[model samples]
Target: MLPALVERYDYDPYGATYIAYRVPSTYDDASQTRDPNLLTDPAAWQPCESSRFGNPLLWTAQRYDPAVRLYHFLFRTYSPTLGRWMQRDPAGYVDGVSLYTYVASSPTCHVDPLGLTYIISPYQIEALIAELRRRPDIGGGLRGRTRTPSDQKAPTNGCSSPFGDAPSGVNFRGACDEHDRCYQTLGKSRFECDNEFYADMAHLCLAYASSEWQLAECLRWAMVYYIAVRVFGGWADLYDFLKWNGHARRNVSPLEPSRPAPRSQPPYTQPPYTGLGAGTPWCPSRRSPYGD
Candidate 1:
């Protein structure tokens, strides 16, 4: 049997209010009908029972209690309407003087997924990289070029690419070796190789992380390694292909119209997340079509 879709909710800038799905139907007052899913005017809408489709979960995958209008977080209850926690932070006041303030009132910059303490949001992944760059040991990994050590179809021994070898507080040698084997295998597609590599590294991080901080830190390094291979891995393939065909491009005559090399595009940034966004909107729109 096919699964039924529950009510879809559109959260406001503050994650306070929700606009439910509006089913379309003909209204007597107008030739056509369009009344915000028809729930606003039940008498005008098709069926009165349609209102029951709403889901209990709201912003950030947190359960919302309509009775108290509070978000049930892992460590504390939060009032998105007030942009404050329902109780003092369990960790006490380390971020600021107020224990109830979310992300030191900088929700746009940070997120507290566990309701324990704030961490830099994905929006600041670039900023996080910059911050990490200051640490010599960690930053050194971020600056190098990458290449497979040998053509030996050995996953275990050839897994350490220059970039992957850098210390990121995470042990990815097993996964990296598997990735190398994938790329080195005959007839193995580059896309498949890269994806398998990413999944391998990510799985290692997931299995290794014991805490939220550890998970985030490990994933950050995973992303760096993944990004490195994706950007430059294509060049490796091209070079290998040319060498196998006995026409190394570097030694080719420059007088000829050198063909433009195919560019490797990193996966497109994800679309603006419109579903269940719970973060405090830094730039609240002056006008909302839903009449917020």
Candidate 2:
């Protein structure tokens, strides 16, 4: 019997396939091997040239035409060669920009995991908040240009108002106060609101709650409130909105979940992957197409 070959892939933080290695099954300690030929061979490994969805484990492209290959990114069909979508975004102009733009035209920094939704990982969120907090401009002037220490003074009554300026803490009142303050100061402008305050509110909500998922749901509702107030210039009762959309649950989480089985097998699940040349697998086995 022929010795089985084991292939391992290494990816960058952005899920880009940077290096790959193939080793014989007989090698008990492959990591200790110091073979220069094995390390330097060009044929042994290939870097992913495509911008978005570089990790082959998660992304599977279909060859509809003999000459061209297209990937179904859930939102639209993407042509790798053209580096654009074959179809316009299904969400229309919700991004308030070009529907054809990919990863908000920033592939290096951002990734659209589901193709339909743009998500920043919890680690990324934490890092971003830390960086933002470090900045003198944002941290020093969190209460807005006009507001001073006196203006941020706590309400006279013992009960905390959502708009009150208080340091974020484990208490829900503190979290809500911080979120409202973020909305007032940073969320007034759409650019600052989405980029800075929204994430800050998410962090604050998560910080106060014991259940991360439940707090995530609250964050979603908070976003809806911000959108209604700032974008549409309308009022929405938070209680009414939450009650109406009670069925809505948290889908995104900070920690990774176990890989679920694919709903359906792809057409190219089997071997004899004729068109795809050497190095690439016929289809990923055991490993998930979603990122680890």
Candidate 3:
């Protein structure tokens, strides 16, 4: 029985493939029997100049035409021999001034699969990741990769309180309700939603307070809530995505916050000079508002 020969392939940094195979002459005719033991030996295997596979392709994504020795990309043709694209980029000078550059001329580090844009993974969402890792019970089952952040759904209860369930504690459920809606709304960022949540809590803490001490305590509790959410909040998964194509969208326009113009002061009117009159000075005792 003859041992099956498997072709071995080697690749260079620039998507070039080298193959090792056997000569056809050894098994050319029925009477010409080759040594099976030779096939198993490493010395028997040699580099093949010609490829048996009709379609030769490149690694950073390309369809190779063996006849022309050129790779057919989506928007450009690449010549592995020249180590550059044969045509200009279809997206014009968006990437850079050089139109024929491939992966910014760095094949080993980057890959331009579609011949349009170079892809690089940016590790972001630190807050979200930290929260997921810190609180396993809450974020354990929520780490879903099947859906994007834009597909997040609002909770049926509106505000599933992350704060203490004790009835006497601050009613942060109202803030959470607003936050949940803000998250579900389109074009709202996670940062924006979280900011609004903090604002709502602040309003609640200050609005109904009767005394200065009460106000201070309420603000303290509000700050605690804000800090908790700020540190251990849910990941960016609970918000709408600003851009999709796997790249973070950059806003080209300036984002000047909306602020009303300053109110103009009226001209001061000088009162007529009044005559001074002498009188005995009287003093009143100051009263303590705190009943001290």
Q: Please give the range of 10 consecutive residues that has the lowest summed lDDT in model 1.
A: 271-280
- Across 1-292, the per-residue lDDT of candidate 2 in tens digits comes to 4332334444433333333444333334324564445555555444433323233433332212212445555346665456556777665554445666655444444455434433333344455445434542333222232211111333322113232222122222332333344334421332333333344454444444345454555455445433433333233332343345333223322222222223352211111111110101111111111211
Candidate 2 lDDT at 233 equals: 29
lDDT of each: 0.48, 0.37, 0.45
Write the number of the candidate with greater lDDT, choosing between 2 and 3: 3
From the highest TM-score down, the ranking of the candidates is: 2, 1, 3
Q: Give the lDDT of residue 167 in candidate 3.
A: 18
Against the true structure, candidate 2 has what lDDT? 0.37
Which pairs of residues collide in candidate 1?
22-37, 23-37
lDDT of 1 by residue, 99-196 (tens): 78876566666566657555445654443334333532231122331222223555466344444342334466765666676556654444334534
Quote the positional error of residue 250 for candidate 1 in Å. 58
Per-residue lDDT of candidate 3, residues 67-150 (tens digit): 676777655777877888898876665445678877656565445655654432112122323332354233112233111122
Give candidate 2's error at residue 7 in angstroms. Answer: 3.2
TM-score of each: 0.38, 0.42, 0.35
- Of models 1 and 2, which has the larger TM-score? 2
Backbone clashes in candidate 2 total: 2
lDDT score, candidate 1, position 277: 11
Q: Show pairs that collide, candidate 2.
A: 57-289, 58-289
